[model samples]
Target: MSISKKTWLLIIAFFCVYVFWGSTFLWNKMAVKELPPFFLASIRFTSAGLLVFAISIATRKSLAITRKQLLNCTLAGFLFLAYGNGVFVWALKWVDTGFASLLASLQPLIILLMMRVIQRKKLQWKSMVGVTLGIIGMYLLVSQKDIISKEGMVIGILMILSCLIAWCSGSLFVAKADLPKNFFVATAYQMIAAGVILVIASLCFQEPWKSPLVWQDNTQIAIICLILFGSIAAFTSFNYLLKHVSPEKVTTSSFVNPVIAILLGWYFLEESISLQTGIAALLLLTGVYFINSRKRDKPVVVAKTKV
Candidate 1:
C-alpha cells in the first residue's frame, strides 16, 4: 500500500472504531424503546455474528478451533452479551444514553481491579488511585436527586454497573483465553455462542416478540445500524488497528467513545446532562485514562526494615 492510501485507511479505521462504536449507545437505546431489551440484543448480536462468520469464511480465514476454545467462547459469550449487554439494553429504559456511557466507561478501572484481584497481579499506585476516583465518580453520579427520584433508578443503575463488571471480566478472559489464533474467527465464535445464549435467555424471560413492535421502522433501522456498524465494522477496524498500531493507541477509543456517546445523546436523544453528571464524567474519564495509560515497570514491593 502507498503511504497516502495507508493514511486514509488508518483514518477510516479510526472512524469506524470510534464513531460507529460510540453511536451504538444511542442506537441501542432507541431500539429498546420498541422491543424488549433481551430480544433486541439477541437479534442484533445474532445478525452481526452471522455476518461476521460469513465474512470470515469469504476471506478464507481459518475457522478451526479446539473444544476448549469453543467452551471458552461459550463461557465468555454468556458473561458478556447474554448478561452484560442484555441487561444494558434493558436498563436504557430508565437511564439515558449519556449516563449509561459514563457507567460503561468504568470498564478500564474495573478491568484493572480484576487483574489485581482475580489474576493476583501487582498493580501500580495509579491503578489504585484511579479505581478510588472512579468509585467517587460513581457515587457523585448517583447522588443526583433526579436520579434517585425516578422509580427503579437505583435498580437500573445497578444493572448497568453490573454490566460494567461483566464486560470487564469478559475482556480479561479474552485477553488470556485459549481461542482461535485468528482474532476475527474467535470473535465470530464468541458472538455466535453469545447470540444463541441471549436468544434463549430472551425467550425464557418471555420478552414480547409478536407485538406490533416487529414492524417499527425506527426499531429496524437501529438494529440494522447496530449489526452493520457497531458489530461488524467496528470489530474489523479494531482488529486491523491492532495489527497496524500499538494496542495502547487502539485502546484510546475507550476514551473517545464515551465522549462521542455523550455528545450524540445530548444532540440526538436530547438527554439532559446535569452539572453533577458533567463533573462525574470528568472524574470517571480521568480515572480511566490513568488506569489505561500509566504503567509501572514492575510490581512495587516495600522492603520491611529490620526491627
Candidate 2:
C-alpha cells in the first residue's frame, strides 16, 4: 500500500530534525570561523524570526497575545537563545564540533538535577543510576588531558556549561510561564527578542560586524543553512513531530543529533575522537536513555534544547 500524505510528511519532518538539527553544530562551527559569533547569531535569528512570522501569516495562525505572554516570551528568548544558543555558537570557535555536541546532549541530566534541587523531587532508583552514569561520562569527557590542554579549551567548556544551565532553566520556566497559545507566535517573539539582544551584545563586545555580502562563500552557505534548515525547518518539524507522535519518540533526536555531529565533524572537519571520548559518549547517552525511560511512567516537565 502506498503511504498516506500524512505519513510522508512525518518521514520528511523526522528527516529535518535528525539531519538538519544535527548538522547545525558543523554549520555553526564553520560560520564562526569567519564571522564574529554574536554578530553571526544576531543575523541568523533575526532573519529566521522574520521568516517565521511570514510563514505564520501565510498559514493564518493567530498573532495575538497578552502583555504577560509577550513578557514571558521575551524572558524565554533571553534564556534560550541569547545566552544559551549565542554563547554556544561562540564556544564553537574553540571547541571541536563533535565534542560540543556531546556536551550539549547532557541537557536531560542537567534538567533532572535541576528538578531534584529546585522542586525537591526525590530521584527514583533508575534516575539516580542515570545521574551517576551521566556524571562519570561528563568527567571522562572533560578530564582528557590532551583535549583540555589546548588554548581556550577550559573557557569553551565553561561557557558551554553555562549555556546548558541557561537552556535547562529556560525549559523549566516555559513549562510554567504564560505564553501565547500558539507556539509559533511565541517562538517568533522569542526569536526576535533573542535577535535584538544578540545585536546589543555584539555591539557591547565590540565585535566588528561585516556585511553578509562580504562573508566568505562557505560562511555564507553555513549561515543560510542555519537560518533556513536549522532554525526554521528543524524547529517546525520538531513541533510537528511532538504533536503527531509520542514525546518520547521525538526526544530520540537528542541521541541522534550528537552522533550525526560526531560523524560529520570527523569526516568533514577531521576532528579527532579519542578512546575516552567514545566511552564517554556511550555512558552519557545510556544515562540519558535510562532517565528518559524512567520518566515515562511518572512524567515531569522536560524542555528540549534547540542547539
Among the numbered candidates, top TM-score falls to 2
For all candidates in order, the CA lDDT equals: 0.80, 0.90
List runs of model 2 lying over 4 Å from the truth. 297-304
- Ten residues in a row with the worst lDDT in model 2? 295-304
| Strongest candidate by lDDT | 2
lDDT of 1: 0.80
Model 2 TM-score is 0.97
- The residue pairs in collision within model 1 are none
Kindly list the per-residue Cα lDDT of model 2 for residues 70-113, writing each as its tens digit: 88988999899989999999999899999999999898999989
Candidate 2 global CA lDDT score: 0.90
Query: For every candidate structure, what is the RMSD over all alpha carbons to the true structure, in angstroms?
Result: 6.6, 1.2
TM-score against native, each model: 0.91, 0.97
Off-target runs (Cα >4 Å) in candidate 1 are 1-3, 211-214, 296-307
